[model samples]
Target: GMAEEEARMMRIDPEKLTQIILMGYTTKEARRGLRSAQGNIDQAVEFIIENRRLREECHREEEAREEEERIQRRYGLTENGQKINITYLQQLQSMGYPRRACVEALKQSNNRLEEASEMLLTNLDTLITASRVAKRDNEDDDDQETELMEDATHIPQLIALGAEFEEARALLEIYGNRLERAVEELLQKAQDSYETMHEHNDPSLFERARTAVEKRMAKKIRLAEQSAADQQRRT
Candidate 1:
């Protein structure tokens, strides 16, 4: 083992090692780099830099892998030890589903794209709404990812008017980014969503007439309030 020990000792230049240390390389690293470069100081310095770069690159890649694993766990992908296929995710995104809904649907449908598509198409409204709630309770990355996936400018504008992020983003898309029109659409969706459930098709004709009239009046009042609010905002 004398040869092995001698090889380990090699010909590390103390001055080069010290210089490398002064440049913030650890003494152990400096010694390794200097020996590897055969005591050429410039080569040693380059070796140290390259070594550190490689290490940093490796560390970054490891962190990315861990983050991906964490996402899979958070969205239930880890439950079955299955990774969401990137191709399917991209396909779903191309189909206009936000990444959050696509991810959840993929998990629920066992990674079957067809079932996920159907689930998303049928329950999109509920999923989009749930996605908002989930995002609000999630981390900064969720906010950043949602911002990237949705219309960045209009969601916040509509949020200031009390719309949820998903709802606001979806409406803005439908109205071709017309902010006021989007707001009106949002107000319309919310205004009678609750009252419509109670509308009776077989009520006494008189009772149906009176309730319908009341709903019309109530809708007009809300619309007026929205218009005044919009006008005030503009001024």
Candidate 2:
């Protein structure tokens, strides 16, 4: 009785059975096929071939849809290639390309993105060279100005004040315009008779002054060292 009931249930639904048969198999053929296989799916594969075909067709359509969407999102067709907007221009400016140079490079390269990037890099090189040249010119101008100022000033004051050649040159270069500060500093040095400003005209006097300064510095160094030693011992 169970086998008979199973056999009756195994009878295919007429609507589904019609669709399958319309695709090519007859109803008797579909039922015979299912019954011969005893409802085993692996054995009834050819009977469900239409379903498998429909599934594969739907999968292909979905893949095509996804590919088109991806293309639109990645490279939306705009009027003038991919939009090189203001943000990109600002980014180029921050990388050190002058505003005029950036615009010129973009125009020269026919607004091609990669070519424009290369042009900006080339302009940066030119700017660096120009900066170096300007720095050198400025330094030369400063040296010339210092020499002119030194020639115009009294050399005897520098020699008498025991100012080193370099210090005198610097003062002449910068302080020639600030006469009050220069005079005040000179007067202070003269009053203090600081060892740095004391000239040693004779070899003996030079040696004597050198020895005195050295001894004074040595005395200070010894006092500092003794204080450090006392602190260390206490610790």
Candidate 3:
């Protein structure tokens, strides 16, 4: 009714006004656009269409961000959904696995703690028997095993260079265990990331990134505390 009233006042047809509203124009916005276009329905609709496109784009971006945050919380992923939980590492440690071994398993299993743990428990000595018995084998299995070993070996080296355990392993696996290449690639990525942030200079983006990292860190801290308590109880 308000749209109709505004349309009547502006000498625009009721049908045109309804069309404008359906195109995501508010009554006031429709009136303004129509008035600026000298009451041309086509011109007003063009304006509404462009404005609606921009609004939809922004809405989609916000929805995507919310979904990502939700997934991070649900799956215990790190800030950018690229890392596993520290809690998983702590849990495996509480189960008597070494930190290095736990890290290796997690890398091999794509961060699935249970799968990694199982892999750690299974004996690789059976590999000789399996190789003798098997008629056909996956060509990539050996390559994958080699890659995992490279990740395991280079993780410590990467940590020595100031990268965290998971971060180091991820970079090495990504760069195919060429240590210098991985380091150079990571350095370049960091530089590019910094330059992008500098160019945008968005405080809100920074805040959101900080909040996500803090959320992951806080969860890890809680896991550490819980693990300590459990160990004390056991002792």
- Each prediction's Cα lDDT score? 0.73, 0.53, 0.63
Model 1 C-alpha lDDT per residue in residues 1-235, reported as the tens digit of each score: 9898777669665776788899887998888788877777788778889988999999999997887676665655622568876568778766556778777677777789998888877776565666667666666544346333345335545776777767777787788778889989877766566447655543455687899999999999999999999999999
Location of the lowest summed lDDT over 10 successive residues in candidate 1: 141-150
**Which segments of model 3 are wrong by more than 4 Å?**
1-26, 35-38, 77-235
Best candidate, lDDT = 1
Better model by lDDT, 2 or 3?
3
lDDT by residue (1-235, candidate 3, tens digit) is: 8898666656866777787778777997787678767678898877767777998999999997775554334333332345554667668645543444554456556778778778756732232233223313433322222225424545545555566666776787778878898888767766767767786775557888999999999999999999999999999
Top TM-score prediction, candidate number: 1
What number of backbone clashes does candidate 2 have, counting pairs of residues 3 or more apart or in separate chains? 0
Error of 1 at 4 (Å): 11
Ranking by lDDT: 1, 3, 2
Candidate 2 clash pair list:
none
Model 2 lDDT vs. the true structure? Answer: 0.53
Which runs in model 1 stand beyond 4 Å of their true positions? 1-9, 78-81, 86-97, 112-123, 129-235
TM-score of each: 0.47, 0.19, 0.27
Candidate 2, which ten residues in sequence have the lowest lDDT sum? 143-152
Candidate number that wins on lDDT, 1 or 3 = 1
Expressed as tens digits, the lDDT of each residue in 7-117 for candidate 2 is: 676876565556546667666666655665565434554645655588689999899667545433432223345432344445554443433344434444545656766
